[model samples]
Target: MTDQPAIELNNGVRIPQLGFGTFQVDSDETQRIVETALEAGYRHIDTAAGYYNEDGVGAALKASGLARDDVFLTTKLRNGDQGHDSALAAFEASRKALDVDVVDLYLIHWPTPTRWLAPETWRAFEKLLADGAVRAIGVSNFLPHHLGRLLETAGVTPAVNQFEIHPTHQQPAVQDASRAAGIAVEAYAPIGKGEDLSEEAVEAIAQAHDVSPAQVVIRWHLQQGRIVIPKSATPERIRSNIDVFGFELTTGQLDALTGLERANRLFPNPDEFEASQFRD
Candidate 1:
């Protein structure tokens, strides 16, 4: 098998620059889609307990016959399980569901401030890392203040922050915070859920590169040094998404794409919104 390029996290863990996302992927279809991705050269798989497909992902991993070290697996701690003990138990449940002894990366799904205990949850993530149950620990949908609190309380920086970022919602502040703290930013919903890829600038860049709008967008994420998890159940789109490694985006092209930012967010901003009600 050919080697795929990897991005090194702040903590020295290596992750594939691009990964397949299983958000909203049905449990029944997870195995097949994940298998297709593995066959197509994706070694990294991103899922969450909320996605409810860890078992299927585990089955696909086994079916792929790839060694455990060869595939990078990531799962998240749901909002309901935010306290230290609750987070730890959630981690175990996730490991059981995925049938993996150790997950490559585990994340706090969201910083639901109303819970008023996100900092304590970070402590649990720290314990998970110290115990070697998770190779690295991070957070998802965290704003600058949430990250700051984690840093202040845990004294350990998150290796990565997975959040909603696309051309429409550039999130410059969060990006700056992550960069300053030496934490990598992983972009979820990198395509903006089919929202703004049709902008004239994005179209022009796609035409210049002779790639799909999705590919251009994913490449833009790569160029910005953000890990991109692009979800696709279709085999052709899956293949097209990772084909970005073969091309380069010029600085001018990247600038033009970045200039298209309109502060449009496709997902809810966890900082302003209350996720406590959504907790199960």
Candidate 2:
């Protein structure tokens, strides 16, 4: 009965467009919070090794007693593990931590171009795909130039390019590049994490639809064809975020949200970010 739609990747893998994310979610609370998300009807769950909560995510899944295939799971490699050998080892560890024989989707986490090492790391990703260790491979936080460099010798075009995208900071240039290359764009920090929830257009649209501003913003992303993952630790908000299927936005309302774009990119610029995932 869930109204979530699935988008087909270039490699023929279908992913749920609406998902629950555990970015800043704490490890101790991840299991319960994720279990709530599952019970609330979220079939897609996004976690990462860098998030330090993959074990909790796995526990939540186990506790729900849902078939492994019943949910689409996605995780990313830490920036610290960006070489062929290291990436391979990291994937194995992540798979073990999540207790999945084959991961639904695996991403490079960030271009963090040592991304001189990106091609090398990508080779490992290709190997994983070839060995059937993962269903699909993609990148996160990549820009046009980053994508360009990665594609120069890329054997498989990335199936997705996840990054920070919201009403206030839409990376149209990046989105255009990814779409043109047939790579799906997935939005992270999709609601600006409350940064722009009070924008005039968003507020107006929400008021008109009798929905929360977060829902208005999420609906905007869905209508425009971007895969969005919104996170909330609170049970009510988690359910509320996914309740977007109940309403539709008019073209004007959609455009109003579009007009709110300031091209204000958040997060580290992939071109210059050199930090790696911190190890405990």
Candidate 3:
């Protein structure tokens, strides 16, 4: 625990560089997976209302026997909950679902450009921060333009911007902008959803380091100062994902992985994905 690295946020909050992601994890199995991650020494957990597993996450946390403050819990407001009032309501609902009094980080799940209510949603986030309901606030799947709009109207700059980032789709431009703004960039699907792990370049790097392809990718993210949340339900894979602090990637190996970037986005582009108009 002492050797693990943490990234400091603009607000001075410290987050563990390596986190466990609960995206696509079934609600029924989320508790067991989360427990496994905790047992494996993962203190940060990322989930979302859209994932519909907050309760499961909460159950695992309660059962872990660790103090509430020992863990960093993050969840997001769903797309439908994008307006000021609804966003506020949704935040409370998420808190309730998680069975926690407060969340360490809260985020706008997606920038619903079609609904065009991100600004309103941001206002709700501001209130949450002001009221101490959330210690940090951020956005996910937000583009540069979306972040610009948020900065222009937000009283507090987002502490983090989470998006799909992997060896195949390293968002350099987005990462640059986030760095310039002092906003931490968090990588979701950092292993390329198990697609690029077998690529020649990643495999070669893994061979050089005598580690798994996933370890090489995660190490790449840590070396670049980006926060990574890789998801896995298997006990061995979950344990393996966080075993990256033992080794470091050389500059050449890091550059090779960087060169593998091809802008191959796995998730929908927020700019083009028409956000569902249903407001809950």
The best candidate by TM-score is: 2
Residues 85-204 of candidate 1: C-alpha lDDT, one tens digit per residue: 998898899899999999999998888887767788888888888889999998888889888877887767899999989988889999899889988999999989977689888888
TM-score of each: 0.96, 0.98, 0.97
Candidate 2 stretches greater than 4 Å from native: 1-3
After superposition, which runs of candidate 3 have C-alpha atoms over 4 Å from their true positions? 1-3, 276-280
State the C-alpha lDDT per candidate.
0.88, 0.92, 0.90
Question: CA shift at 144, candidate 1, in angstroms?
Answer: 0.6
Q: Rank the candidates by TM-score, best first.
A: 2, 3, 1
Query: What is the per-residue lDDT of model 3 for residues 1-280, given as tens digits with 9 covering 90 to 100?
Result: 3247888898988888899999989999999999999999999999999898999999999999999888989999888778999999998889999999999999888887867798888988999999999999999888888888888988899999999999899888888887789899999999989998988989998998899999999999999989999999899999999999889998999899889888888988888766553434
Q: Which 10 residues in a row give candidate 1 its minimum summed lDDT?
A: 271-280
Cand. 2 Cα-lDDT: 0.92
| 1 versus 2: better lDDT goes to | 2
